[model samples]
Target: MGKSKEKRLCKQVKHDVLEEDLDGYKKLVVNPTHLCVKCGRVCNDPGLLCEPEPID
Candidate 1:
């Protein structure tokens, strides 16, 4: 797989945040239901995270 696809959203968002890519960030966190345990980043899809835990 390509590097981008291999990377979880948690890691990808770090770069997006650094570059101020608000649009990209928004697309990843539209309606977050899970949070990354490693970085505390929230996303709708748990598969996108390296370590995800349900928000509830």
Candidate 2:
């Protein structure tokens, strides 16, 4: 039997921001390209992705 890989929430992904992070930024991936919207089109490093939208 093979073990299934655990799904990581958005918070698990490293964003450029230091104070803000959560389990929703994973949606930033654009279709077909998988690019982050918050980081715009220039940023490539996941660690450099813009902070995820704040949760209220």
Candidate 3:
């Protein structure tokens, strides 16, 4: 059998994922997700953290 990299990876939420899923995760800027797929440590009380940018 091949060495599976996801051997120890969890399939649940973990990190503070953004509300929206961008195409190719580009807008996200990186591989961001609401749930930490590795440890399943979800942000139960994730607050709305964002900056108000100029809407043009």
Candidate 4:
């Protein structure tokens, strides 16, 4: 079986933040518009999340 191709926002945050990629992380979070229903993470791009819903 093949693994899923999508990379969720929560995973990105863990990777970018832990790796000290503040700039990359900032671009993802700046002026956030969507919330990840599954992980409760927020990001500007809904496509980055596993289950994204509009934030307000």
RMSD of each: 3.0, 11.8, 13.4, 4.9
**Stronger candidate by TM-score (3 vs 4):** 4
Name the regions of candidate 3 deviating beyond 4 angstroms. 1-33, 44-56
Q: Which ten contiguous residues of candidate 2 have the minimum total lDDT?
A: 3-12
Greater-lDDT candidate between 2 and 3: 2
lDDT, residue 45, model 2? 30
Sort every candidate by TM-score, greatest first.
4, 1, 2, 3
lDDT assessment of candidate 3: 0.28
Over 7-34, each residue of candidate 2 has an lDDT whose tens digit, in order, gives 2223334434223432223343423232
**What ranking emerges by lDDT with the best candidate at the front?**
1, 4, 2, 3
CA lDDT scores, all candidates in order? 0.81, 0.34, 0.28, 0.79
Angstrom error of the Cα, residue 36, model 1: value is: 0.7
Top-TM-score structure, candidate number: 4
What lDDT tens digits, residue by residue, belong to model 4 across residues 1-56? Answer: 33334766688666656476677667888999999989998899898888899999
Worst 10 residues of 1 by lDDT: 1-10
For residues 1-56, write the lDDT of model 1, one tens digit per residue: 23456667887876666376677668779889999989888998898899999988
| Model 3 collision count | 7
TM-score of each: 0.70, 0.20, 0.18, 0.72
Residue 41 alpha-carbon offset, candidate 4, angstroms: 0.6
Clashes of each: 0, 1, 7, 0
Candidate 3 per-residue lDDT, tens place, 14-48, comes to 22223222341243223333444334333222221
Greater-lDDT candidate between 1 and 4: 1
